[model samples]
Target: MIAKIMGVLNVTPDSFSDGGQHFDIADAIQKAQCLIDQGADIIDIGGESTRPDAKPVSFKDELVRVIPVIKTLAETTDVPISIDTSKPEVMLQAVESGASMINDVCALRVNGALETASELGVDVCLMHMQGVPKNMQLSPVYDEVIEDIKHFFAGRIEACISAGISESKLILDPGFGFGKTYEHNLEILRCFDEFKSFGLPLLAGMSRKTMIGQMLGDRDVSTRVTGSVAGAIIAVQNGADIVRVHDVEETKDGLMVLGSVS
Candidate 1:
C-alpha cells in the first residue's frame, strides 16, 4: 500500500511533547509550513491533550485553541488539514474553515460526531480507544486485544456506513497507548499486519507515546523521536498505510530508505 505521512500539529498546552509549545497561532502556522515543506501528506491538528489523567477542557476553550490554526492551515497548506477532535461542533466548524479530514480518536461516538462527518463527506479517521483519555489506561483489559480493536473498528465502520459515509473515506487507527499497557501496545504493534483485514488504510500514531517511553524507560517525549520513527517504519513494513508523526523530516527520511515501502 502507498503510505501517507500525516504530520501532527498539536495546538494544546498539554499534548505530551509539544504541550504549551504551539499553543500560539503563529507558532502553529510556522510548524504546519515546516511540516508541509518536509513532505507531509496531511496535517493532523489536535486541540485536546488526550494524555492519560489529563483534565478535560471546556468546549469554548477547545474551540478557542483549534479553530484559528485550522483556518490558517486550511488556507495556507496544499496538504489536507485534519482536525483531531471528537466534538461534533468542532468538526463542523473545522470543515467550514477548510479542513479536509476529521481525525477522531473517539471514533465519532460523541453525539453528532458521526452525523457531522457524514454531512460534510470529508475524509475521516476512526480510531480505537478503550475509554476516555483521563482514565483509559487506569486498567484496560481485553479477551483478546487485536480482536477487540478490530471489533471496535468494525462497529465504527458500520456506524459510519449507516450514516452514508463510504468505506473509502475512512481510515482506522489501532489507538496505541490510548488505553493500553505497554504490553498491549506491543501486542498491537507486533501483529499490526492483522489490521489489514479491514480493507482500509491503517494509521499508526505512536510518536513519542507511552509505549516507546515504557520500552526505553524514557519519560521525556522529545527523545522518543527515533523510537517513534522506528515504530512507524516497522508498522509500515507490516501493513500500515499511514504513519502519523510529530517529526516530519525524520520520518520522511527514514521511510525513503526503507526501499520496500512506496
Candidate 2:
C-alpha cells in the first residue's frame, strides 16, 4: 500500500531540523499550506523539540506556540492536523482547536494522557521511545529492538483500550531516532513488516535525522534530504503506513514515483 505523508511543522527554535524556521505563527501557517500543496495527507504541528538532550517547554509556552497555528490551519485547510505533544492539557486544547490526531512520543504513558486522548475522541499515534527526550540517547540499550517495540506497542494498545479509547483509533510509530542507535534504527527499518502483524497503521519519522547523517558521512541536517528521501522510500516499501518528514515535496515526489512502479 502507498504510505501517507505527514508534514513536519515545528514551531520551536530547538528542533533538530527546521527549528526557528517557523517559530512565527504567520510563517507556520504558510508552511502548512505549502505542505498541503505538496500532497501531504496530514500536518503535524509540534511546539516542543523532542530531540535528544532537548530542554522541555512549559505547558503555557507550548500551548501558546501550537494552538494558534492549529486553529488557523483548521480554519484554512481540509487536511487532517496532528498535534505532536505528550501533555494532556495540550492534547485537550489541540483537539478542541480542531486537531484530529494526537501524535505522542510517550505512547500515552504519561499520567492522564490516555484519559485525555480518550475523552477528546481524536485519533492517536502511540510511538515507542526508550526514555525521556532529555536522556533518551545516553547509552541507550534494548533487548531486541523490534520485539521490544512490539511489546511496547502491545502494552500501550491495551492501555488505550482500557482507558476507553477505541482500538481502531490508535496508530503506531516506531520512532526511528528517539533513543535508538544507528544499528537499532536500521534493524527497525529492515524488520518494519513485523509490526504490521498488529494490523495498525505504522508511522515512520526518519527525515533529516542523525541516522541519515551517520550513513551520509556525518552530513549536516540540511544536506541529508536525498538520504532522507531514500530512507523514507525504504520504510514505505517495508510497510510504513505514514512517513513524517521535513522535506514534504521531495518525499511526496519519491512516493509518487515509487507508487507508479509498485
Candidate 3:
C-alpha cells in the first residue's frame, strides 16, 4: 500500500520548523485545510514544541492551543485528527473535542497516559525518545540503537496491553530525531523495516529535522525540504506506513512517483 502522509500542524510559537507560523487559531485552521488539500491522510496537531531544550507547556495551555483547532477541523473535514501530546487530561479533552488519535512522544509513559489512552480507545502512536525533550539531545547513547529501541517498544507494547489497550490500536515511531545523533537516525532509516516485526504500522517523521539539516551541510530549516522528502521516500520504501511531514505536497509527489514505479 502507498504510505499515508500525516501533516504536521504545530500551534506553538516555538516549534522547530513552523512555529508561530500557525499559532493563531485562524491560521492553524487554514494550515490544516491546506494540508488536507495537499493530499495529507492525517493531520497531526501539536501544541507543545517538543524540540530539544524546549520548555513544556501546561495541559491547560495545550488544550487551549489545540482544542478549538481540533473542534473546527473535525467539524470541517473528514480526515483523521491526531493529537500530539502526552498529557492524559489533554488526551481526554482532545478526543472529546474530536481527535481520533494520540501521537505521544512520551509513548504513554507519562502517569495516567496509558490508562487515559485505553479509556479513550483511539489509535495511539508510541514514539521512542531516549529522554525528555529538555535534555534528550545533550547526549543520547544506546547499546545498539535498533535493538535498544526494539526492547523499549516491547515493554511499552506490553504495558499498553496490560492497561487494556488492544495491540491493533497501536502504531510505532522510532522517533527519528527525538534523541538520536545523526548516525543513529541514519541507521534507523537504513534498517527501518526491522521494526515491522511488531506487526503494527510504523510512522517516520523526519521533516525539516536536525539530521536532515546536518546531512545537507547545516542547511537552515527552510532549506531542508529536499532532504526531508528524500528521507520520507527512503522510509516509505523500507516500511513506513505513515510519514509525518511539514512539506506534505512535496512528500506526496515523491510517494506518487515511487508508487508508480514500484
Looking at model 2, residue 260 earns an lDDT score of 96
The regions of model 2 sitting more than 4 angstroms off are none
lDDT of 2 at 112: 91
Q: Total backbone clashes of model 1?
A: 1
Residues 1-262, model 3: lDDT tens digits = 3999999999999999998999999999999999999999999999999999999999999999999999999999999999999999999999999999999999999999999999999999999999899999999999999999999999999999999999999999999988999999999999999999999999999999999999999999999999999999999999999999999999999999999999
| Predicted candidate 2 versus true structure: per-residue lDDT over 36-142, tens digit per residue | 99889999999999999999999899999999999999998889999999999999999999999999999998899988999998899999999889999997899
Scored by Cα lDDT, where does model 2 land? Answer: 0.94
Error of 3 at 224 (Å): 0.6
Off by over 4 Å in 1: 260-262
**Which residue pairs show backbone clashes in model 2?**
none
Span of ten consecutive residues with least summed lDDT in model 2: 1-10
lDDT of 1 at 259: 55
List the global CA lDDT of all models: 0.89, 0.94, 0.97
lDDT-better candidate, 2 vs 3: 3
RMSD of each candidate?
1.5, 0.8, 0.6
Q: Give candidate 3's whole-model lDDT.
A: 0.97
